[model samples]
Target: MKFKNHILVGVLLMVNVFVFAQYGKQKKADILFNKFSFVKAANEYRELIENNYNKDYATRRLADCYAYLRDPRNAARYYKKAVEQVNVPIEYYYSYAQALRGIKDYKNSRIWLERFKDSGGVINANDFEKDVNFITSVFNAKQQYFLDKVRFNSKFSDFGAFEQNGKIYFASSRDEGVSVKRLYGWNEQPFLDVYVADVGTKRNVDHTAKLKGDVNSIYHDGPVTITKDGNTMYFSRNNIDEHGLSKDKKGISNMKIYRATLRDSIWTDIEDLSINHSEYSTQHPALNKDDSKLYFSSDWPGGFGGSDIYVVDIKADGTLGVPTNLGNVVNTKKSEGFPFINNEGTLFFSSDGHPGLGLLDIFGTIQGENDEFVDVINLGIPINSNKDDFSFSMNPNGITGYFASNRTGGRGDDDIYAYHRVPTLQVEGIVSDAINTKPIANSIITLFNDKEEQIAYMVTDENGFYQINIDRNQDYKIVGSQIKYIDDYRTFTSKYLQTELTTITANLLLNPVQDVIKLAELNTIYFDYDKHNIRKDAALELDKIVSLMQNDYPDMVIRIESHTDSRGELSYNDKLSIDRANSTYEYLISKGINPSRITEHEGFGERRLTNGCEDGAKCEEKDHQLNRRTQFIVVKME
Candidate 1:
């Protein structure tokens, strides 16, 4: 995500176009827009729109303003009007899709996405359809994080939160000195500086205060990384030295990473890293857990993209070795940088080149079994957006982490967000035979979702203990069945607790079946969405159950109970459910199970819901599907 601020001479050219031809609010707004003062530009454009002046330009500028500001809902609204009035840019379709995604209008996002691709879009549309499918699953497949805005965030660009020992360090561009104001050419805001805060007695951090003296420099200072011992540091700064600001051939000052040592709590002896050069840029340094290697982003020559992550070995004598690119798998033809590696050797970074839900999505890669890094996966939605998200960091505890985003609903242009992963619900206990009260080894423990569809399967350990992961505020059923024992069923719904993680112990004791093992706690039959026809997979399961009953318990009786979820009218559901039950009975008779032996079959309709997902109660498909099911019971003994 690009910040709406002046960064280069190109922006002055954009400003000149607006200044030369236009006047009044439109031109004034354009001036701010060229300078990347989106907040002010949005205000001016909104004023013109309210007064019904320059409708086309006003609407377009407003849309651009909100889009740059990461307010997608507003961007989508204005873009709609702009498109209706004048020609909509092809990139607007991509922006529209991102806005729709941010507000969760995924289906519409797809529609606009197709329009984007059809409008001659290229360079970043690879794997578009595949990513859309993956996104849908991610939206409903249980979120890994719950996020909240951090406390010390200024109304400016505040990000890069890192912690060590009892001190939390970060970078912020809050106001420094108005008397001798200095603004970054790119964003026109105060330059960044590394700040320190004390780790709180209860919370992770307390209050933020800027670094003193040498640590705070005349130029853009920080976004720092420190060694484990905390006496050494690496930070980003402008291209400058004793002779003054260093410039490349184009007269553009580049960024460089500097190393400093902590002497008596003061940072001194600052020197440029060996990788720094006046010819190209290198910044954003991260040290490994053992400090054996230093990784940083560079836009040097021979790189695959404008910027790529490179690593250099930290020699035993505390000097840097030659730099090496992270390779093509992690880098792309487009920019990829801001890398942070956790203790597990997983590399997390932000990139726009990879096909994603939106701009600069955060991605993670783990050390492959046979490779250095592989399995790069997008950290979809909430954690990422169409906006830029970078400078990712994770604490030592692993349950919580921090990152920076320019996405909507933040306190600044770029704000830091604190995220916590939901702890897994572990279902673990012993399984045993009911009559013998002895551990049943190798029993099958199948975990089913609210829809009574199996999601995971496990075998009992030597102690007959079975364990599986589950979720809170959700329904799950666990079934245990040994080779000779009748399957026993236990259903539970986990709840929120004080601790971050929770466990449920369910000791399942299966009943022995000598002659006829009546179908108990087993509901394998399934139907299409609201249809009564049995599917091939359902038939496969039913065929096995029928074959077992006909061969072993020819004289036994069986019962079929069919049910439907609480949707549509009650009368319609009742008829549909009864038809499902009759369909099951007919299918069983087709398999040669005597109709006389199966004397019981009925439809429950929606009279009894497994949960309170009845009509008028808001629910998702999974919750409502829980009520639609089939179960079996023994009616007569052999």
Candidate 2:
């Protein structure tokens, strides 16, 4: 028994030593990270984690180190592990969510954000609001619904995928005939091509067509994106033509972005992006959803790394402006490439130099203030394996993702694969008059999500239709109303898994009231003198009155009254006021109001005066104008 006790003591001592060693390593890593020696810090933290000592703290630190090193995949892996093992602190959840966002997994990121919120985590709502990528992700989910898949395999190399119109575009070198190629001074096949397939049905490519371009010849053509209208195409091209090759005479083996015009559904007249230069290698061009900005990967001088992502504004005339570095938060000393910008403006890129799982893995971040990137996160595995898993693409909805890997098993050196993504929900509907089966144009619709947050509000179109997309697994309340009608309220619940068009139709009925009510609330009623023409201001006032009547007192009717000052004969003034009131009534009718509900004009020729100032009795021009105004009143409040 004494011997056993001694053995136990020895084991405890060894454990203590291990723990101390881990603690010492962590301290050193923290110091390194504090000093901005993120690479060194990541190494130390990785060592500690590998030794399985102080794993939770070590993993957390490791993740932080990786983030500082600009390696989000490894960072995310450790963060996920840390969260799973213990009650993850709010900070950890925030970090994890950020990592998920880095890879454009906004749905999961949102889930984590909610978790963070539930754990009493403090977040600046404004920060989230300005996060374009996050906002885009939210918008995508609310706009459409679909099941997503993350395809994996051990074969041909696959990289990034982009969706435009009803087609999927991606980059791959799987069909390379040569056994070896070279990229960025690395030995690899020189063959990379941009391929497209139909994305309307299941995630299947009917035929993989290579992008047509001389610049795409015998080099890498990848990381492609097209404009929203599919009129212009932008992509990365490595190793320029012999005429523009580098000084070394090796075909100027650096990458640059090229543009092409899509005419009659075919790409024509390929042109180099005006922003490209021979001195710096630029690749992986991605355009914002609005095509207002271009983001790309480069190793140009004045950058932070072997390759860093850069952005430039696309001017209205299709000219490119000076490129701006994405800043140190996203760029590191190591290479960062293969950037993909979702419709929401979240940035996804791949890096080897950052603290990551192995060589190269996908990472995510968002553009922050001063054009800096914040919340750098690593995508965790299966998405990121031990091997290099670079090149990522996502749909506009932010649920599904596609990336390239050389893991194993494929038709060639690399093969493209599709992935399943999370689902999102949106709400859309129409508003109309209860009496008429016609579309209600410009009916106000307000949507409040389950979080009791007013997500959006919009007016119906000429057809009285409105739409508000929201996240799944949430309850929503919609309030619809228009002028002269009672407000309509409806409720709905949506889940990601559900596939159905959710619609809300609200019909409002108005009750008949009196003719010629006072227009006390209106600011002005602009009109043409002596012409009885209602101006823009007059139209606006009529719209407001219509909205209140429709939404607040749907069952109530109203009357339009026109008044004239004593500047003219009583007969002339009465006729003018009557014409003006009728004109106002006609404008309302044109705006989709029920004509039957509106009573005829009640022209008062200088008979009523609130200021008691007669037109010829020292009345100011303002008073005369006020007396000549048009008024609307509820004839019936039902």
Candidate 3:
């Protein structure tokens, strides 16, 4: 009995020691996670979960670690286990939904999202569902962008690409060949520094160097923007002073924006912006088209998300106005940053809150009527993957640009990708007067779809040129109109567009409404040898006249003349011609054309034969058919 008791006590002591060791490890993992050291925390938590120590807590923490690392596969795996527990937090349901979305399992994502809603989640359930469906359809649509990884990407994180003055500026953590290497605990990479490289015509980079200035610091730096004049610049860096970084109560050093001036071809006069707060972050500076405003991302208090985009006006004396939040439209309930405003005033930024393919997708928005950014659209596909994609920058031309992504098949944790969008399918043309061929300035050009719904419109420039982007494989109608000239329309389809031919030119010529009558370019109205009643072919031709007079020239009046082939008797032919003219006029009236537009109807009975098929001349059926015709001549314009 004594020997058995001693063995049991020994077993208990060993189990206690194991439990204490697990407790210590769990504490360490928690500390690392709280400090944002997700890479190391993920390793620690994985071991704990594998050993079945504190399985519930460790599983959820592991899932969170993967989420923070932007690893959706592993995150979904552990989150699946975590939420299976009986008393899991409701927020985990929302997290699982987002993780499922990252893996493109949108059907299951919607299920969990609905569950999250039923469990009292604060998100808009309907909007998220609609966004999922909309984004899925867009992803299934034709791809419009092509991306290539730049050669200068380092083995470490290399991202946040910008371009100015023939050089590409980016942030990187590459420190090869340096005497001493400082590693960040978050991912064990070197501290980020601003780097620049000459950009080739094809966006290729063969060499890179640290930016030439005192702008780089031992801490995180870079992701910059320059003014149009190239004499001023703004960049982001960790909040620091001579005594080292300024930290909040939690010992986290947030980022701050700094302004620098160019002198002697190097950036100097580094000054931190007054808008930064020690308790929050303000980084990722961007300049508007005219340099009158500055945009950036921050985690400032009262923000709708972890980070929200804000804008500030630049006064004439180079001072900044009060910062204003971009509002809930552009800012979501999750992080939104890395703003880049193109010359056309379109705002492009990265967001994780919006329904997307994965972690952080690039979105574009245009200013709405209320001056708020609206119509946010995910860039979709090749620009975004199932990983973190951000820091989008595009030129004013809206085709070529660069973005950063940490997706698979990259050389580093994050890589800069050069992207070129396929040219937008567009139609362009000149509008001119029909008589003198002079360019018609300020003429309205309207575009309609197959449904006859107006989709877009623009006015001709001083050069009488107008261009409009259109969709592929769709039928469209373009109409040119001026006050003094009759409107002209051309219908065309974009079906089977040539791969190399992107632009469709459709010039329009408008006729002036003068004292004399004018004839519209219509297919000839035809009749049978002895028949005068309207035929299917004749009805089709008459519809054109009806449309031109009723829709294009509303106040115009017309006269109709009809004829019959010489094969018929002259008396019968004359009666038949009159019937043909009367039938044409009646069809127009039936189709809603004003009767006043047809002032007279007369029959000529083959008197005006168009060819030598007259009398006894031997001619083919097609030759004689030409003489059986009707003509619509505009009589008066008011």
Candidate 4:
């Protein structure tokens, strides 16, 4: 069992040239597998396994075939058997772990990943382990896309959509009824060809035909990008010429990027880029906003992964510069390809290396402070699935685009989907007091759409934090309110959301009610010397409390505390303070203030004196008067 057989299994499906066994049947199946014909090769290997002819080799080849077919369930099943055999190669442990991930069996995936690491297999195991919660995070993320299957999708693979000058160019394996039919060995479908369609509106496919002239080849071709003027095109094709495919020393024909000129509505002047090499593949060309740079994916040497995205300078003379790999920020230890650059200079690509929903999810880049791409963010759900998703291209408007996926519920093995971005606008922040800056827990935050109708509302947590998702391109108003504070109003619109998900910080500062009992600056209510009755001046102060509770804060609940001067005995002072508290409570009740509004009315006696008027202390008359005072505490304000 060779380790090379387990790596680089698709696109440029490189396999070790060694014969699995000396038997004729094993040799035939090995040739089929090497030709990227996993469908036929799987059948052959399955038959050999049934007959018990070199069962070990047949079983291993069968697992590799299913893995190429993107059937992870069957792949995991066979890989389990292969790894359980004697003298199992180290690659099977890693491959089996990946297969388990494809089926979302993360617990078992981690087990195999640890085994692979323990066996000294330096692969994506470390990264895979760190992404243990990746699936959960992807599913829980805000939905960023609404997808629909394009009408032009066929029973075969239809994908790679690029928009140019009101026309849509894509790659498809649909049989076009050509008298001489050619089929790709990979899935028995017709060889992929570039097709053009007059798409007047988004996702509308009418008037379709093959691209004119030398662009479409008998071998795989297309998934093309055109210049702004639509006169120049760049596309991917097999590394072949007029004679035959140019094979490397290992007998493998890799992919290459070609440039063509459109003359008189016919494409011609096809020239292979100088950067292409026979040993590796460079495909999926995407130009920047100004066309000064071209980005593509390749499995060229010195890359960080099986395939990595690279860029080259496009000179005025229509030639290319030296290729530079996008560093670890964009490229990982696993395969990444299908680069697309939007007008905003944001790079989008597909990757199995990054944490995503499952195998090969689309990811976007976040730039650092130095204007270099740093963080890679998964595009998340709908746009990604538990299967291969790639070839993401956006239209000039930047809101609508197309990508390909082999996930379930598609029209074919690989279907092209037209997606309109549903801009995710998240309003989040803390609701705090304007004066104290303390979190106003249990504050109500309400969201209203453009029509002024309340869409949703939520209560802030103990930390006074809240978050809400709003629709794109719509005006919204978020209001925060608490019982004791005035409403905080904020209005914004999502019409200019630049990213797939835009987060707006709407930290609210609520103003506390000026005369609320909690913060009210009132003169202390005093009493005559050692008297248990409310004084005339004290009645005036108590009336203020009554008016605030009755007219302004009708739902105010309060607690009253009264104290006595320290000149009297402790027991006598305690009784006098109690009488004063009752008198004040009765006064508020006589003014029609609700009795239940006073949750607690108790005398603290001389314990909580406002002045230094303790017993046996020398104090002025005013000092003792300050000690014999009643204070109001606002308990709840609705």
Candidate 5:
């Protein structure tokens, strides 16, 4: 079927599958490789390598074989070798990073991903900042999910689950004898068919059987979304006509949505929905509360690109209204599909374009006041993986859900995993000016979990109040940032222990940036005669300046200027004064200030004196002391 995973993993199963070229003898491996039989491909490649047939080429192919086979350990080992070999493809480096992530070696994965990026040529998305931040926050935020591969999964691919009438219905590609004995050229898996089984236990599914109707065709029959009442259904199927299957201009068959009605335990009156297009594919249908709106993924004309989530009104007569693209916030130039709308109206979908760990990562977005998907949030890990993760479903209960993934440890190619949200502990507070206690509104407050990874970010309201949900019994860091003010950061733990700060009231303080820019008085450094070492009093004074620059005035630069009385040789005074300036500059460097921000420290020697106590000029000791002092110049500010 025409597919685009353009949206996610599901469509990739059919569309854009790469075919390996035929190599002369033992075309054996190429056949299996093209069939998506990674396991067999790896074995054959290993044999070829053992026979000493172009080890470098075989090794790279072998690594790719293992990568598709989902054996990350072996994939990582061989990919490491492949990346170092000559003529390695840019994609090989990305595959190496993905393999590393599959093995939970994320730090190393980051290293290889950087290498892949540095190797140039756009291997990953540019929008990775939010994804990186989200992954960091999940580093130690106690695993909230207890995942178990569903028992009903076939040895082949099985996913896209939904519940109705105490029976679980899902899509699978098990080669049941009754179906047509044809293998899909893309994956060599049997054509997908919808199956139903009695509601099984959490770990095991009861006996299963294919749906009895005109649903399963000789061609691709995939995911189905049914209404709450279970009478109406929208499913994906290869575009077929009375003359048989139809092909688009690309010589590829397209996918279309077929609606059916269930009557007396049998699905009947099947008909194509109006949202389909002959030029593009539309699949993965979903619905809102009253089923008045039908949502699905499509690559029809006028889309941003790939597939985008589109909603159409389900008219009273069961016809589709005009489809509206969810827009750039939810859809990107890349694929975004497999939409699941929860009861709360929040749209959950998977996309490769959004900031993500890798591949297709799940993102959540709700319609804002303007009725648009705004501020999409990556669902984080366990729900997401470096591999393709799509086809998410959350029950109306608001806690339990199911999602599909081909990550490291699945029972099948794409298994459905169950998830339940754990209770969350929340932190709420107000931010204000430290000195006057005035509310600091609209400040950005970031919360980092125990692992020092940011877990949540909030903007203070007009009242300076903010709240964020967090995991219980874990340590956290709250950092507040606002323009023209210092970052207000605090570290606190969320716990119920007697000694813990359970009744937290983090009314943060943000010192005005302008307050620190006036540094002349506070920036003075005094040195004993002929001594360039920083003194205790001077060291204490520098601490305040360092803190402000590091916390608030990040773009500010300072210069340390030293002057001296003309009591000694001109050259001696210049050298001594420069030494004093160097001593002060080094002090700030040791305190974590960037050397670039220090600009340059210079000494004018006796050329410019604060007092006339120079050469033969008579002056009191205080006059000489004034010229011995060091002063700071605000070289730049932002």
Candidate 6:
């Protein structure tokens, strides 16, 4: 009996030691997993499972590690083993359901999801409803129709898409018959060129050719963006000079960023971007939806690892500020790149080290103040695959996503694919005047989504045309107004509509009002040098005048009087002032004001004076411009 007892005690001690060792390994794996060191964590978990200690716990954790690594095939297999064990935790059911979802087994996923709900778990029903809604939408006929219509034929790897002014700009590596292939490090495909496609017909892209001129060079140039006016382009290019040229005579070395101007519908000379350099690679530029800020990926010094996301302010003059790291919340000690920030402040990025579905998967988080990021979530399954997936772009509405993926069925090493958020509705329309059958220009239109929040605002163009984009799942109240015109409000709700382009026209008729007529309250108007031509600033102010006249005194007729300083010859200055007043008069008439409602103009040359100025006065040019002005005086209150 004593001999047996000794042997048993020795066996217990060995078992305890083995268990402790396994526990330490599991703890280490958990730590790395939390920090988004997914590859390392997966390896650690795999070692624990191989040791065969606490098989249930080790298998479960290993499955989670594989999920983070974006290896759903392995993740699902191990998760199956974990769920087969007796008395599994409720959280394990949720995990298994996610694995099933990642593998596109929605029916089985629903089974596990329902089991989780029945196990006295307090799940957020709204989130489950959203997932279900999205899945149902994806399985719908319309989604399949769109998928069938869009072809994936390409000659090179393409990505980093952006849409502006009904045109799509993206990066590609296709050969343009250039002799030497651009090379970056060991990667032979360093030649990235920017290409543009017009969405003129809405159904297809007009890829008639690459963007006009030096836009497509022999260097790696991509991730292009344009301001709201479409005059200036901000793009990333690699190579030679501080002006974005290849230093090598061959024009195919190094990488940097540059800016170019668009004149006469063609890209002119290019200037090097002042913010980046060859010492550290900076690529994948994304402008904020408002074009107020710029985000990009950089492998510069002081970063967490291989690369990280950085941002800079876009000055009004188109200059970029000093780049600032996005901090640890959005970045890790591993590779973090391909960042995209939407209009709603939601950030999407691709990371190799984060807990995801595969080698590199896309992730999303909400940006917080003080350069913080929170609520990190993995974009699972179809959106993220087991292969390298990066370079994603989304429409302002966030309903559509375009990304580059090397997944099984593609045209080349990488191809562009577009995915639409399931169950989305669209809000679109045109803005016009009430009285005349004419479009309005410079009219501000605001759209408020179902959450009673402003989602988008657009101005009517010279043709009085505007389109407001909205998510399909919600209701919206749209309001359109212009200064001097009555505000027009309308409400509409959308259902399941899969049309590529939905057209909704909301015409507004603003009746003229006759109440308050306050003049002299206007600020001084500005004019061009040596001419009475109305400047843009002057037109903006005159818009206010039109608004007041239409809304406050619709039937009132007015006389526009032009004035000039005492410097110029009397007749010349008088004629200049008269022309200036007539210019304002013509603009109002073009904007739908009745000609009879505006009386004739008078040029009070040097007669009217706020400041006594004889010939050769030492007044500033600003003051003199102010003296050469136009005024609208009420002629008759109809």
Winner by TM-score: 1
Identify the superior model by lDDT, candidate 2 or candidate 3.
3
Question: Candidate 2 lDDT (Cα, whole model)?
Answer: 0.64
Q: Candidate 2: where are CA atoms >4 Å away?
A: 1-155, 174-190, 200-208, 212-215, 242-252, 367-371, 408-412, 423-638
TM-score per prediction, in order, is 0.53, 0.44, 0.51, 0.49, 0.47, 0.45
- Tens digits of per-residue lDDT, candidate 1, 88-195, equal 556667666666665677798788778878888642445344334322222224466678657777777887788889777788888654467677888898888888
**Candidate 4 TM-score, true structure as reference:** 0.49
Q: For residues 1-638, could you state the per-residue lDDT of candidate 5 as single tens digits?
A: 01211233333233212111112222456445433344566777887677544355568778866654445788789989988875566667777777777777878877877887888835436423223332222222345455654677767777788766777778888866553467778998887888777666454442248787878787877688889888888899989888777989997788998988888888878898777877789899888878899989998878897889999998898777888888787889999999988766778899999878779988866343344543466777789989988898877755667888888888779887877655334476667766334466779999888788877876775546665656567888999999868798889876653322223556688876754436654567777777788889898888988987888778777767887777789999999888887788788889998776665677778788865677999888777777886788765556
- The regions of model 3 sitting more than 4 angstroms off are 1-141, 201-208, 426-638
Cα RMSD of all models vs. native, in order, equals 24.9, 23.1, 25.9, 22.9, 23.2, 27.7
Candidate 1 or 2, higher TM-score? 1
Each prediction's total of clashing residue pairs, residues at least 3 apart in sequence or on different chains, is 4, 53, 0, 0, 2, 18
Model 2, poorest ten-residue lDDT window?
A: 135-144
By lDDT, is 5 or 6 better?
A: 5
lDDT of each: 0.72, 0.64, 0.78, 0.77, 0.72, 0.66
- The alpha-carbon root-mean-square deviation between model 4 and the true structure, to one decimal in Å, is 22.9
What lDDT tens digits, residue by residue, belong to model 2 across residues 424-524? 23465546555333455657787887777887777764545444446666777888776656677777776445233233233333222223333354344
Better of 1 and 6 by lDDT: 1
Q: Write the per-residue lDDT of candidate 4 for residues 137-212, one digit (tens) a residue.
A: 3223346578864787777888889987778899988866667778877778888899898774435342248898
Query: Candidate 4: which stretches are off by over 4 Å?
Result: 1-140, 200-208, 425-638
Off by over 4 Å in 5: 1-144, 177-180, 201-208, 425-638
